[model samples]
Target: MHRPTPRPLAIAIVAGLLQLPAQAALYAVDPGPYPPAPASGFPAWYQDSHGRTLDLCLTKAVSSRVAGAPGAPAYMCTLLPTPGVFDDTQPIVFPTNFPDEAFWFTADAAIVDAARGINLSFGTAIEAAFAAEEPKAGDQVSFARVRIRVDVPVAGTYTVTHPYGVEVFDVPAGGRRAINMTRDIGIAGAGDFSGALKGDVGPFLRSVNGPYTEGNERFIGDPNLDEPVTGSPFNTNFVRIEGPNGIDLRTTVFSVSGKLSEVNRPTPLIPQRSTYSRHTENGNLRAQQDVFVMAPPAPATVTLSSQTPALALGEANGTGSWYAQSVLNPALPLTLQVTADNSLAIATSTPTTTPMPLTDLVVISRAEYSLGSGQLTLVASSSDETSPPALTARTGNGTLIGNLSGNGAVKALTTGLSPIPPATVQVSSSNGGSDSEPVVLVP
Candidate 1:
């Protein structure tokens, strides 16, 4: 399983001794995927797999008020790490004492309020919830889902530590518990909610009705209420809380589905090296070539063949394709020819052709010259039907022996007169090529 790296918890502490303003004004309400409307900022709520709405707040001001409400409060939600900021950018370290037990908690509205206050009554509820939902033997408990409300007032942007999973903590015995709520929870993986807010309204209807639909017989009124809901999913994070006493901490894993624009961008095309080769007519010699290309644009083709019948040729292969050929005669020298066309369309401003020559040669005859003869005679045969490749002769130390004719005949040579070893003769043809052979010179 590929888990995303966890980021440092952006802990927003709620200190009892710290003083706050007597009153604070409401900034805005983020309704999230329900009651469709364009997101004014990062979402303050998200729906779990169970279809329950989890309200997220950046500060304790709103969350504490809701958590302390007399009746059923909105689901408390916390921010998770943003995929853009935390994913692949930071290391996630799990606590050494992290618990292994998993338990589910379903607190009544009153208990939920008490939990928000981190009180004894809330701990009692947690114990009960754990006992009631303990997993049976042979069953696996991956996470715990507790119904709690959390909110923060100082909101600009903050990451949710866990998106699809809940974080668990063991509440220690009474003391100034330095509980860093931020650092306590572990991060699940990434989740996307892009399609969560998109309503089932057809595209045609959306275009005709604008942001909302007119009241119809099938429905009471416009569900959208003329609110713009089309936008990208707010990539954020979430957190869950449990235990100070005997509460066993464990996570209840859930899967979040949808595409994230931050992670799903267009993939650009890349160019690969192209190749080709010559083969024999009897299918003995085989040369294989391959190339890689992306689609939507037409795939490119590579051409493989020798200029002359000295070497057999094979048909061109499609992009990422290969072919085989055999040499007609192994004893003679041959050149494999390769040409790539349109392979550079994706990697260059303008498409260009690429050609390469691969040589296979075996020496057949050596050239002989007399010292101070100023002349040399050489003869050789090759696989090239063109015959009589261009020739050059030189000493062991690279001193020019003299220029030679296409038939391996040279005149006006001078270096061979020295006590140097036999000069080296090299043969090449327009289509067929050969390896260099030693030339013997006599005084």
Candidate 2:
């Protein structure tokens, strides 16, 4: 029986602010002065115990409205999810260069050989931690050793901190995702992109936007920037993820940005909210940027049904099954939930419905596929009572396995990625609710 979903009245992971939505299209903010971290090839940070470390040293004060004033000339950075996730607010903040080495990080335990040739793939399931706006250098910020599951091969990208770090884990035969869960990233700070930002900030961001976007960090590579999450308009823009050894990654970023203005469709998100800024007093940190934190007023009787905030990729091994649309009732204003895990909730959003009344609340839940550096034979299936359900499958951003039929499935293969085993393979459904199951090839 279809159970009518009720309004969820729970605090998000941060317990300070509510997330927007996990999968909402994020705006192109600053990747905090980083040209995409290496997308593929060897990882930038890794560890022996299935975990990786990222050491960001704060040398100078990160800008806060120039003179700590609103609308001041400052290049500010806020932690946001890559791959268009915006709901996460209280991201995890690790001391990359903390005074000691005892810090620990319970990292997302999934890795993939995105390319067959030891190509690393980072997991976007991890959210970002908006650290205090401050300097970058001298002050050591260490991503505590993130532990990967010892059994699965940690071979892809994983979110160590605000940036992406490559990790590798041991995988037994038939093992796909093996990352340790209790290690930390320990490194010193080193980067000179600040020198590049001297003359023009736009060029610097543009140059690095590809790496950021490809790394699933925030960058304005989205061609579908104009559309809402569910609307088809989100597909209009082209934000491609390129690896470090990505042959076309650099070029593609340039091509898209060159014509971004001409596209004439992409616009800034939260137009009313200027880039965020903060004014810190002795004890209070006031927001210099006037942020209207209220959600866009919804009209309908929208409510959330259920959510799976946290998921272990290993549990998704093989063809597992989960659905997010069971809470959707055709009558009440549609309020559906897929994940309730706080860690993965980095990209969750509050719900608001104004115009659309609930006729059929359905979501193409958790539909995604990633190919490592090898022969990836992908298969996707769906089951629902809907007659002759519409299904679609396309690959880009994250591999989009479109709508599925009523009890339908789709499959495909590719060697286009780097030659490594997949850390994890994600699957999702579009219409009549949704489901995602990892295709653990090795396991």
Candidate 3:
């Protein structure tokens, strides 16, 4: 969901009260959920065993009101993800020489890898600690490490990365891991871009922390003004993870001025929220940006009511409902019923009234074929039972099989064709419901 930025007057009032010559500060009004600290201390998942670290360090802040006292400004600073790699082994400094009044704020971070069913938990202790740093950076300095941990129940190859750092680990069937790393909040700052207000008077500072590799961070300032900052449109500064079968998982934080907008992509596997505002506080605009890394919902489980070991080509067959269990929504059950004519229909309600046509569902279930005395019978089934199934048949390798009649039966027009492998009958319903079974043709 997109959230609109605050009003300009609100930003100006907040900025006025918090603005100071030495520095200015903004507080995270709402920090989302954080993973809980394990009772048994940090687990194996929490440890940085691979010693993976981030290469870039920077922060972004933007505003919506670009024509008044609270003009939108983009602020940034250069820092390191780990300690000792830079001068003196100390953490990167916030509010570094950026011409704008620098301040630090903290927001809740919720990181998830849905594909592996992994959701991070930062206990109340860490949540409180993260919330404690408000309006200013107190006791928190460069290289401050926050411990993050996750337990993989099913296990496989799991990768979790954010703008601040990245973690790629292979877990056993049932295992856990933990690691401690610096928070991105340490290296964030804000400034104004409207050009109407100079210095850090009405600057807003925010951070986009995720694992997006391309166009991860972007900042578009007012174009009318001359002497605009070179990096007016900020890009890059994120980590990208490649998973099994060309699955690309990119996570990053995104913010815009006018109205809150999400990170735009071709096919976004997961849905995330952005931290953005249009107005300013005491002339400064600041908000906590929550980054979400989501995986596509798991496929639904499908089961056939009865299995037919073998069937005659010309014989008419009957089958029960295709029971489907949804991974995301289990309470709502789904069933696919196939008529003798191969008409497929779906039922969401128990009584099964007002069954909509399969065309309305817009999903193709499966193509079935049977053999008989010098003849072939082809049938197709889908989730919609209202409309008749298509009369066309095609092979896995794109060869034309045969066309079905009005009753969903087809006879082989060609002779002397070799026996093909048994066909597996399968159908998929809405919301990830699917089922399949094998049946052989008998002489």
Candidate 4:
């Protein structure tokens, strides 16, 4: 079984602490398919089985066109600190984590910032127009998704990246097949690249998303061998990072001149926690981050507190309807007291109830019993309002059960019949729900 990472539990020292409203979404939609082609370069970064582009951190909007070099027209986005800015005048570098590989798309960008709480009007307009005609695999779906979250003071604004997966693969500019690298020597191999490239791998470079390694770093050539080489991570090429906040990065083209380059980063109060790969094109060195503005390590003291709010069950679709409602108060774990709201509309007495047993095959006069047979029996019936009880007897396999009258007290003689070998009795309600109840036939 594929198990998910277990989360830690928090203890509450105080009983009543201020609790935030529910933050997780109860329902979600698929982000859609993966980019068809690998970006201009970066073959090693292929779309995983799920169809998302490897360097999917940055996806191009429908309006954008793919250019061979930097400074073309494309939509670059990122997940930055809340209230992040997108200036048409400033040079904003959207950091794709593979800093060493050349970014596939290079163009002018206009960001609709989520951290700043900007509504996705621009993207929505494009989607509305295209909604009249949906986009299939080959066609482009201009409907760019905006990752959104609410802002709480202590939590800031939670950030998520929406990977747009429609038509950004092999057209004139997209790729058809995924290219694989580093099978034998592996992702980072030994005895590759040499001399000045190793000093600061900025040479021997090529495309984005593909795999390569540089510098004097060591790699596993075989199952047992591990050796070093002096070369550029890639062959001396450059890539650009474009986004509003995806990368907490500040540098555009990090040099992979073998020696570590200063890939400027944001001064995040919360630190980063992940390892980087030496894989690159030009034997160059650059920096990277897996997730954007991840929350700080869980607080040492996590306090879960809340006041029990009023909760009620909504309408029932049917008996088969899976009814569930969680009144998740950070504080109380109370057992729910469930009862019928307007029970008068429902039947007062159970349609079919199993009663106590009598002799093995024979049923008693006054007692009710579902003796593994398909009928309920009245043990006895009361007479008139002012008269004594009158009785009747039933026998054999074919018999019907009747309701009590007058005082509705069933004393005797309403007994029903049972088969030679009684079979199980299944009761079906008018509401379509069914259950088995006891029945018996007596001599």
Top candidate when judged by TM-score against the true structure: 3
Residue 166 in candidate 4, Cα distance off native in Å: 45
TM-score of model number 3: 0.23
Lowest lDDT 10-residue stretch of candidate 4: 121-130
lDDT of each structure?
0.27, 0.23, 0.25, 0.21
- The alpha-carbon deviation from the true structure for residue 166 of candidate 1, after best TM-score superposition, in angstroms, is 51
lDDT (tens digit, per residue) of candidate 3 on 1-443: 01111321111111011212221111111121211221011110110101111111224332232332332233322211222222312323432221111112111233467765444432100111111222222322121122234544454455544323344545445444322222222221121111111111111212322212223443222211211111000121223443444545443322211111221112111112211112234865432211121211112112211123211112111111122221121122232221121112111101111111111121223333345553334333433233233434444444554543444211122222346643543333232323344534556
**Once model 3 is optimally superposed onto the true structure by TM-score, how far is the C-alpha of residue 75 displaced, in angstroms?**
11
| TM-score-sorted candidate list, best first | 3, 1, 2, 4
On lDDT, the leading prediction is 1
Whole-structure CA lDDT of model 1: 0.27
User: TM-scores across all candidates?
Assistant: 0.21, 0.21, 0.23, 0.14
Preferred candidate (lDDT higher): 3 or 4: 3
Q: Which ten residues in a row have the lowest lDDT in candidate 1?
A: 121-130
Clash totals for all models, in order?
Answer: 34, 102, 45, 76
Scored against the true structure, residue 315 in model 3 reaches a CA lDDT of 15
When 1 and 3 are scored with TM-score, the better candidate is 3
For model 4 the local lDDT of residue 89 reads 31
Tens-place lDDT digits, model 1, residues 1-443? 01111322222333222222121111112233322111112243332211112222121112221233343222221112333322212332111111122111111111122333332111101010011222122221121122222332221222222222222333232233223232112122122223222211000111112221112211111211221111111111223334333332222222111111111111122223322233444745544433332211223333443444322123232112233344333333323444333334223222323333343232437566776664565555443322334444555556655544443221222333445455576644333444476777666
Clashes of 2: 102
Candidate 4 residue-wise lDDT, 233-344, digit = tens:
1211212112233422111122111111122211111111211111233664332211111111111110111113423223222111112233231111122222222112
